[model samples]
Target: MYIHFIAIGGSAMHNLALALHNKDYKITGSDDAVYEPSRTRLLQKGLLPKEMGWFPEKITANLDAVILGMHAREDNPELQKATELNIPVYSYPEFLYEQSKEKTRVVIGGSHGKTTITSMVLHVLKYHQKEVDYMVGAQLEGFDTMVHLTKENDFIVLEGDEYLSSPIDRRPKFHLYKPNIALLSGIAWDHINVFPTYENYVDQFRIFIDSIVKGGILVYNEEDLQLKKLVSETTNTIRKHPYQTPEFRVEDEKTLLQTPEGDMPVSVFGSHNLQNLAGAKWICQHMGIDEEDFYEAISSFKGASKRLERIAETSKAIVFKDFAHSPSKVMATTKAVKHQYPKKQIVACLELHTYSSLNAEFLREYQGALNAADTAVVYFSPEAIQNKKLAPVAEEQIFNAFDRKDLQVYTNPEDFQKLLEQQHYEDVVLLLMSSGTYGGLDFNKIAEWIK
Candidate 1:
């Protein structure tokens, strides 16, 4: 089979390209620009376009299908050409559904815990030597590509994102998966630019629930009232399974899970992660994995990349970086770290990078989100706002929106780095939370300074 990608430089797109290439399918892709890891990986697989930018000439009748990335606009040249030729076109999520239509599809969805839950399931399955096709949001340990596909795999585990499937496909990505088994960790309003209101944002999850295949199972976080309401209202022909934070305790800075075999020590911690583990456990159970076997495998799971990932550590201090820009994610991450290291002084810094996070209306949702930290800092670049064509936000507005009078805000990366460097590292933990690089600040350099 031959497949062509329009805007293949995306994290997920490039991974999918490589996965298909590894499966012995002919893969070709074009993008105006390609960045680091994706570009490097594509070149390594000999899938990188000889030249960047869309080429309508590349779209031919012989191609089996054209997979579109979210980065590509509806009017993208290659996309227009594909439409002209009447060649089969698919949004990434749509194509995933097509590939796994005959297999048991397990989709992990939620506002915050999707990546962690997906990673946990993948880790447990790998531990048991279960062969499965998968697409996870984050790069995980022991996984060469974030996406993997093979003819032998009878199941596909997908990290279901609530965001749009493609520029032309306005529907949420998760709606296309039609999972035989699904998990929703929690619901928190996000993507202000698209959904606008919290109620509208939540409606997407409800749609996802209605889209599940008949007789499927839904594993959801019962602690979230929104999720509870959605699940209660759903009349779909699917079994509902509710999960909450499991029995766990922190001992000497280690999180131990209470299992039938006794307290099994795990590398991951926090109420959010524990809830994620519970959700993943239920999904694994549905996949024919027993609780004991699941716990035994999960005990060694560290975490998903950039979801409270430990970047650097010393005996005196530790530094963590998390891809947490949304209000709920920021709150959970900050609270989790503080709870995990109660004795340490916590310095939590977050960057307002995404369009939703920078929107004036959405800023109010972040009220007191960082209050758990001993010291809280928020960063935003005026240049970023301009680049995204968003209305400029003042530091005062951000500070007031957070409702934290003690919060420190920065518009400069150098000053932010200097402020961090001045802090004494002894008995302290630094958490940097952002979806984008903090104005291109070098995390390794900052780690070295703190060390």
Candidate 2:
């Protein structure tokens, strides 16, 4: 198959490009801008476009399909050309659906735990030597590509993102999956630029629940009140299974789960992760994996990349980096670290990097999110706001929004680094939360300084 990707530098798009290229399909792509590691990876695979800007000539009749990334606008030159030629165009999620339509799609969806849940399922499947096609949001250990597609794999595990599929495709990406087995981790309002109201953001999940294939099973987080209500009201033909945080105890900072067979020690911790474990367990059971097998396989599962990933650690202090820009994610991560290391002084620093987090209206949702930390710091770059075309936000506004009078806010990374360097690190757990790098601060350098 010959396929072209518009805005191919995207994380998912580049991964998909590499996956298809490895499959020996003729792959071509174009983007206005490309950054590392997508740029480096694509170049290594010989998939990177020779030049940066889009060229209408890249779109032709012989191409089997055009996969559009979210970065591309509706009027992107190649997109326009493809439309002009009536060539088949698929949003990244839409194309994924097209590729895995014949397989049993197991989609993991929610505001926060999607990546972790998807990673857990993939880890267990790989442990059991189960051959499957898959797409996970984060780069995981022992996995070469975030996306894997094969004709022979009968199952496909998809990390179902609720964001808009593409600039032109307004439907939430998860809606297109139509999974036979689906999991909703939880619902928290996000993507303020798209869905203007919290109710509107929640309605997407309801729509996603409605979109499941007939007789499909939905394994959801019963602890989330909103999700519980939504699942209860849904009279769809699918079967509903709810999971909460499983019985677990933290001993010496290591989390162990109480399973039917015995107590199984795991590499991941936190109530959120425990809930993720429960949901993944249910999904694995549906996939014909029994409780014993699931526990054995999951014992080796560490975690998804950047979802509470340990960056550097010393006997005196430990540093963790998490991709947690949303309010719910921030709270969950903070609470997890504190619960895991109650004796340590938790110093949590978060970057308000996402559009939702930086927006004036959406900032209020973050109230008390970082309150679990002994010391809370919030960082945002004015340049980022300008780049996102968002109105400038003041530090006071952030302080008020978080409802923390003592919240230290920073507009500079260097100053933030100095603050960390000056802190007493003994018996402390430093949690760095952000979807973006904390204004490109060298976290390793900061970690060394703290150590």
lDDT by residue (2-46, candidate 2, tens digit) is 999999999999999999998899999999999988989998989
Q: Candidate 2 overall Cα lDDT vs. reference?
A: 0.92
Query: Roughly what TM-score does model 1 have, to 2 decimal places?
Result: 0.98
Q: Which ten residues in a row have the lowest lDDT in candidate 2?
A: 442-451
For model 1, how many clashes?
0
Model 1: how far residue 277 lies from native, Å: 0.4
**lDDT (0 to 1) per candidate:** 0.92, 0.92
CA error at residue 318 for candidate 2, angstroms = 0.3
The lDDT, on a scale of 0 to 1, for candidate 1 is 0.92
Candidate 2: list runs displaced more than 4 Å. none
Error of 1 at 299 (Å): 0.8
